[model samples]
Target chain A: MSAFAALVRRDLVLAARIGGGGYLSLLFFMVVVALVPFALGPDLNLLSRIGPAILWLAAVMATLIGLDRLFQADEEDGSLDVMLGASLPLELAILAKVLAHWLTTGLPLALCVPLFGLLVALPAEAMAPTALTLLIGTPGLTAIGAVGAALTATMRRGGLILAVIVAPLMVPSLIFGVSAANAAMGGTVPFTTPLAILGAISLVALVTAALAGAAALRGGE
Target chain B: MTATGLAASFWNLANPTRFLALSGRVLPWLAGLAALVTAAGLYMAFFTAPPDYQQGDTVRIMFVHVPSAWLALFLYAMMSLSALGTLVWRHPLADVSQKAAAPIGAAFTLLCLITGALWGKPMWGTYWVWDARLTSVFVLFLIYCGILALWRSIDDPGRAARAVAILTLVGFVNIPIVKFSVDWWNTLHQPASVFRLDGPAIHPTILVPLLVMAVGLSLVAIALHLSGMRTEILNRRVRTLTILQADHPSEGGI
Candidate 1:
């Protein structure tokens, strides 16, 4: 338990010192949202209709941009080897790494989504759902992305490969996230269904990553 | 009773060597079966199967469309199981099966998409609908291509297998999502009919042929897979011999 915490703490400290991967993801997200208004003209209604989708799309891309780095840094420095050598379970190590990744990339992206929402001409009511969806869905991004990160840890061109592998799985999360935002837009039956499904996806991703990543890591050694 | 038992034992020949040997002998037969069955099925599909009251001659596309679609989902499911077998049991042949199945699966998926579009053009007046089923299948295609690309791009076979195993398992999430997307979302695609709680919606006339084509395609896939496994095993042997030659250059008596 303490080891897990220490791993997370160490990762956080490292993220802090290196300025994290947050800013880069946010820059990508913001730039995408910023471009949407120009592409659609000044038509507020048009922008609002696609506002949630644009936000969700930007969030997914942003999360992916940082995902390849989730395990690459550890794999490169040989710390992953030492960690594997430790008595601690690889599953726990994977969970810890995913958590740290979520904190650095997912969490911050969720935080910055509302600002992107505004740039895309989102209605005020949609902001809460937009942010909320990101909050719930981002954990799934981190969890599933870890599997890709682990699998492609040794590949030099892992980023593109990671996207190809992970993007399809990201569909459900993207669907629900945007659906929740769209639901919030129309004030329909609360965003509970999508939120719940998104949470389930994250749980499943967590378990799957733990098992698959452990096997992958062992094989890598 | 003993002969019957001996016949059933054939199913247990799951090793690559045995499978390759058996397939080597049976490949011609299976290929013949595939060609004959598909040819008969297509004839019935285009000429015998009456045009749908609603869809007209364009319904002919259903012959290819339905079969390819079935193969797409079926192939992925098979790949996932092979992936599981490889990961859990370290079944050597399972990796070969997965590597072989990917491109075939992707091809089926491509055929499904194309035939679907061709069908859609006259019936729905659009080649693409963004409907729940269509979109999910599209995503499935992407996943299939991704796995195939991953398998091909990685140089080391063992590493490639391990990497693709994780990928295939993760991507399996799309299967259930694709199955239920229509119920979950308000999309243009029709909901499930064949395997639904209410039973298959289509009449027996269409259903029987669909079933035959489905079986035929499965047989073809099996045949293709067997031949592919044979080639893969030979490739592995050639690789090993080359490595041995590299290690003992003087042993060749030059």
Candidate 2:
């Protein structure tokens, strides 16, 4: 198998086997959604109106919560150094890890947007659009968080600080994601515009963030 | 001089001892000039500039609010250049400059926000709004905090330098984004009253003092930044010596 494919599979397997932070972030996503209805009251009308935004915010928090482990584990096991020296190229290796991370963390949250959406009283029509937006934009979140993760890879407990550093960078994604989702719910603006922009952001992030993350990982060591 | 020679001369300014000597000699004059300019600006703003026909005395807040907003954005831009110097050119002084600038930049941004809120309360009847201009500035403030947090988390200065440089460049992306956000979204924040294609909307009475305040405050900010960079250099030297002492117990304390 190609080194990239092998590295990706290794991360997927590790995340599945370890099964703690990944699943925990998914649970955290749900718990955040569940907590909101309590604060905002049980008004379904109000809940559905703002449901997409609630889901998007929860998704970002979950992505951030799971981000630190993206590089921390590799650093601890010294596999990061091994990968750095490997012929696969550090940027591509980081890309593969981000892909695997998205699969475990971002993809699951996007997929579960509907299940969690129900708790927030998201209307049925908006469910798929909300999920779709999260699906498209969460990859950008994962990528941006990857740079933060790589930069803090050497720190003992970088989780909280990583969130602080990465959160503002995630703003554009959140804005467009919620904007796209909101448009689908019968807003004045068309849904396709923000959705397209969200895709462009993810596309840009996938390349620049991988390169930046690699540089950070290399510098951090 | 050729471009390379010009670059060499510029790079020489990164030398710590030379920087200290130059800044020490220059510092007093810069500080005095800043005070003089700032005081004159304030006097003009208060005693000379007429009250807005509309906003009256409250319009005077522009002297503090507008200039701080400019500096907040300006310092971030300056730090971005310093970030490029650190990452692309590997200038060590660039790291110190960038590091020193973060807290000062944060201070200006905070000052901008507070004065803005103070102005907004009387003018707009609310101290806060989620208007695009306000939101983007708030985000800029958060980005400043994040950069400071990242710097604090990393102990080794060299490693911290590179990491923060990369982060600085990343955050720099937001400046353009913030600028256009006002255009993209319908903002409650007023349109450009000062920077217009034709001319400023304000009469010279207000414009003059505002300009004076802006330039004076910027000079003050620069003076503060120079002292900040100097302190950072001394701090790093002390840190290195302490680490060396930790490693060599037999050596006498300095």
Candidate 3:
């Protein structure tokens, strides 16, 4: 547990020194969100209707861009080998990494989305669900991205390959994320339904990454 | 040969040598079968199948559209199964079978989507809509392309297989979505009558030919798959031998 915590702290420290995954993804997310209103001719109704979707989609893409750096750098530098050599279970190590990932990427994205919600003129009531949806959803992105990153760590041109492979799997998260936001905007269905589905996706992604990551390690060995 | 016998023989021809030989002999027959079945199905569809008062000629598009859709699903199912076989059982031909089936599946999916759009344009007065059924099938196509891209991108053969296999397994989620999308959401697409509570709403004329073409396409797809697996095996063998020759210099280096 200490090892996992230490690894997370180390990663966080490194990120803090060099501007972590969170800042970059948040920057990308805000940039994309900010641009959409301008491109759409500053129509508040149009922006309001589509803002949640743009935020969610951009969050997904930005979170994913940082994912390529998740495991590959450590594995390449033999930091992963040292961890494997240590007493900590790889699964726990992975879980910690995923949490770090969400903390670094997902958390900031979640925090920044509400600000963009205003930029797009989304109703005040819609902000909470949109933020909540992103919070529940980005963990799944990091988890699934872990699997893709691990699998492609040794491959050339891995980023594009990772996106191609992982994006389809992201469909469930995308569906639930968009739905939750739309429901919030529509004022009919409770936002809990899609939030629960998003949680389900995160759990599924966690299990899949652990299993697939194990297989990937075996394949690597 | 009976269907069982043909199926057994195809399995036996799973060996690349036998597969190549058999497909070489049988390609012409399978080609003829596809042509005959499609021509006959088209004829039956136009002249013999009674037009619906509601859908009219647009209903005829279902003849091509539905089968293509079914083929898309069927091919992906088979491909994923083959992927499992490759990963678990290490079937000599299984990976090749899965790899070969992807592009063909994508093509069939493209056909289904195009035909659906053609039918929709006149009926719905639009080229496309994000209806549930349509969206799900569209996702299916994306999955197919994704599998293909993963298979091609990785240079390492074993790693590529695992990558594609894992993705294929994950992408199977689209199947249920495609199947139940209409039920899950109220869309411009009609509710299921052909595969549901009441069972088969269409008349016999339409049903029979649709079945025929469906069977015919599956057979042709299998034949094509067998031929493709044979080519892949040969290609792998050539690659392996070349790598071996490169690693240890032969007496004649060339």
Candidate 4:
């Protein structure tokens, strides 16, 4: 238990010190949302309508922010080798890393969705739900992205392959997140329906991604 | 008793030399059958199948479209099993199976998409619809591309096999989600009329060719895979020999 906490804490401390972890995704989230208006022409109504989807898409892209370096950094510095030999199981250690990663990268981005909602001219009623979905969905995105990260942990340029590899895996998260957020806006479907599914996806992703990432890490050795 | 015997025989074939020798004799027969069956299937598809009352000539596209679609999905199933082979059993042939199947899967996916589009143009009056079924297929194609890219990027065979095996497993898990989510996202698409059998009448004219084409394409796929595995094994031997030759300049490698 302490070892897991320590791994999580160690990752958090490293992310905080790195400064590259959180803000890059936050900034990306803002940039992508900010660009949508320019691309679509500053139609406030349009922005409000597609706000949830735009936020969701940006959130998905943002989730990929630090993933390439997730395991690569550890792999490069040889800490990964040490971790492999540690009393802590690699899957648990990876789960901790993913948890820490979601905290620094996904959580921050999700929390800021409401604030960035202003940029998209998102409706007041929809903001909370959209942000809520992003909050829930981003964790799954990070977990799925982590598997890609572990696969390319030893590669020189993993970022290019990372998005391609991760994108297809992210379909369920995107579908559920966007639909759930849209559900909040008002429709025959209740908000809780897709939201529940989204939560389930997050839970599944957390388990599966950790196992997969650990497999990649061990297999690479 | 038979099950254990079958399992024993299966394991014995894991030796690449034995696999190669076995496949070598089977290849000609497999290739011939594939060619013969595919020709028969195509002939049946194009010539025998009646034009649909609703769709007329465009219904012929289903013959091509549906079978490729089946192969696209079926190939993934085979790849998933092979991925299990690579990861759980560490079968050398499994990775070769996976590597060879990706391109074939990709080709089938591309065919499915193109023929789907061709069918859509006449029936739906549009070449593409951002429908649930189409989107999932697109995602499947992308997954194949991603796997192929991953395989190429890694140089070490053993490591690449493991990494890609893990990736293939992830994809296998995700594909169902992709299919389900897309189905939820758009239930309005995939017109019932287009499928023909959805109309409460199962016509033998349509059923026979579709099944034959499916079996034919599958055989073609298997033949390609067997030959591909053979080539891969020989390639690995060459690679090993070259590496050994590099080690000792004075002495030639076997």
Candidate 5:
């Protein structure tokens, strides 16, 4: 347990010191959210209607930014080899990394969704649900992203490939997240239902993706 | 035979040289059978199957579309099994089978999508809808392409195999989620109409041809897979030979 906590702490510190502590993802999230208004034009009604979806898409994109490097840095510096040789199980190590990633990237992205929601002219009623859904869904995104990162960790330039591979698997979370937000925005279905499903997806992704990512990391070696 | 005997026999064929020899002997016969079956299936589809009461001539496309869709799902299932073999059993040819099967699966998926659109144009008055079934199949196609891209990007076969296998397994786990999400999304938008639980309600005349076409397509897919495995095995042999020659120039002539 200490090793797991230490691993997570180390990753958090590394991300803070090196990857700008989620500031980069925040900037990227803002830029993506900013582009939607320009592309769709100044129509507040349309923006408000699709605001939750836009925020969700932007959150997914932002979460993807530094994922390819999730394991590559360790793999390159030989820490990954040592980690594999450590008394700690590979799956637990992966869970720690994924947890750190969610903290550094997914949590910040979720936190910023309300601000971006305002920029997109999202309805006031939907902002809380959007933020809530994102908070639940983004861990699923980072967890799956960990698997993609591990799969492509050995490749030279595998960022695009990792995105291609991971994006389709993320469709369920995207659907449920948007649905939950829309439900909150006065749709027929209750917000809790889809939100519950989104939470289920995140839990499942956390477990399965950790196992798969560990297998890929070990298999690559 | 006992379970171990069966397992022994299966692994015995997993040997690359043995696979090459066995597939070489079977390829010609399988190719001929595939051609004959497909020709007969096409004949039955065109000549024997009567037009749908509602769809009329447009119903013919189902003969092609349904089979391709079935094969698309079947191929993915086969790939998943092969992935299990690769990762759990470490069978040598398991990765080869998975790699060889991906593009063929993708091709079937594409065919299914195109034919589905063509059928939808007349039936639904639109070429496409975000309907649950159609959307799920589209997602399947995207997944197939992603797997193919993964296979192509990695230069090392062994590493590529393991990576792709892991990815395939992950995708397999998500397939159910994709289907369920698309179904839920569809209910929010519109209900599904393609196929339903109490059976399709298609007539025996149409059903027979559809079955024939489905069998024919399955045979063809199997034949293609066998030939692909053969080519891959031969390619690996060539790579080995070239590496050996490079290491010892004097043995190059042999």
Candidate 6:
């Protein structure tokens, strides 16, 4: 347990010090959200109507941006080889990395949804639910991203490939996350149904990513 | 046969050299069978199957479309099995099979999408709908493309195989989720349609031709896969020979 915590802490510190970590993702998320208003013009109603979707989309994209480095850096420097050889199970180590990724990237993206929500003219009533859905959904994004990251970690110029591989998998999360927010915003479907499904997707992604990511890491080696 | 007996027979053919030799003998026969079956199926489709009561001539496209859709899903299933072979058994031919099947799968998926759109134009009044079934198939197409791209990007065949196998497994798990989400999404937005393609009420006349076409397509797909595996095996042999020649230039004069 302590080792897992230490691994997470080490990744967190590394991300803070690195070039493409928390701050970069936050900036990218903000930029994407900021661009939505300009693209849609000054239609507040349209912006508010689509606010949840835009936020969710930006959060997903932001999570993907940082994923390429999730294992690539360790693989490059030989730390991955050592980790693979260690007594620490690869799946647990992957969970730690994903947790750190969510902490630095997903969590920040979710927390900033409300702030970015204002720029998109998100309705006041939907802000809490939009943030809530993102908070639930972004871990799934990180988990899925980790699988893609592991798959492509050994390749050169893997960023685009990782995005391609990961994006389709993200569809469920996006669908459920946006639906939950829409439900909370007065859609006929009950808010709880989609919300529960969204949470289920996160749990499934977590298990899938850990097992698949470990296998991928071993396979790539 | 018992489970062990079946597995032993499977592993017997898993050797790449043996597979190459065996596939070489079978390829001509398989290709001929594929050609004959497909010709027969096409004849029945065009000459035998009656026009639909509602769709008329447009219903004929279903002969091609439905089979391609089935092949698309079928090839993915084959790849997933090969993925299991690659990961669990480390079968030598598993990677070759997975790599060979990807582009074929993608092509079938594209065919499925285009034909689906063509059918939708006359039937649904729009060529495209964010309807659940259509959307899930589209996602399937994207997944196929992603797997193909992953296969191409990695240089090492062994490493690429493992990575691709893992990705394939991940995609397999998500297929059901995609289907469910799209189903739920469509349900929330629109009521179920009265005329689904695989509806329970298909006429025997139409069903026979559809089944024939489906079998024909499966044969053609198998022929194509066998041909691809042959090419992949040859490519590996060529790669090995080239490396050997480079190492000992005097022994083999280019």
Over the stretch B149-186, how does candidate 6's per-residue lDDT look in tens digits? 99889888889899999999889965564445545554
lDDT by residue for model 6 over A1-221, one digit each (tens)?
A: 58789889999999888756888999999999889888889899998898899999999999998799899999999999888877889999999999998988888888887788889888888888888999999999999999999998887688999999999999989998999999988968999899999999999999999999999988776
True contacts kept of each: 0.68, 0.74, 0.41, 0.79, 0.79, 0.88
Segments of candidate 1 deviating more than 4 angstroms: B1-15, B182-187, B192-200
Docking class of 1: medium
User: How would the docking of model 3 be graded?
Assistant: medium
Clashing pairs in 4: none
Clashing pairs in 2: none
Q: Model 2: runs farther than 4 Å from truth?
A: B2-8, B249-251
Expressed as tens digits, the lDDT of each residue in A69-175 for candidate 3 is 77778878888889788788788777888888788888888887768888988889889889889888988988888888877777645788788778877888998
Q: Of the candidates numbered 1 and 3, which has the greater DockQ value? A: 1
Docking class of 6: high
Winning model by TM-score: 2
Candidate 1 lDDT, tens digit per residue, A120-175?
78888888888888898888877877888888887777899889888887887888
By DockQ, is 1 or 6 better?
6
DockQ score for model 3: 0.55
| lDDT of candidate 5 over B1-254, digit per residue (tens) | 99999989888898888888888899899889888988998999888888888889898998898889778888999999999988998889998999899999999999998998898887888888886667777888888998999999987788888999988988886456434654655443233233568676667888888888888899999999988888887887778788898899996464
- Clash count, one per candidate: 0, 0, 0, 0, 0, 0
User: Candidate 4 falls in which docking quality class?
Assistant: high
Ranking by DockQ: 6, 4, 2, 5, 1, 3
The TM-score values for the models, in the order shown, are 0.92, 0.97, 0.91, 0.94, 0.95, 0.94
Q: Give per-model CA RMSD.
A: 2.9, 1.5, 3.5, 2.5, 2.3, 2.8
Which one wins on lDDT?
Answer: 2
Pairwise TM-score winner, candidates 1 and 3: 1
Candidate 4 reference-contact recovery:
0.79
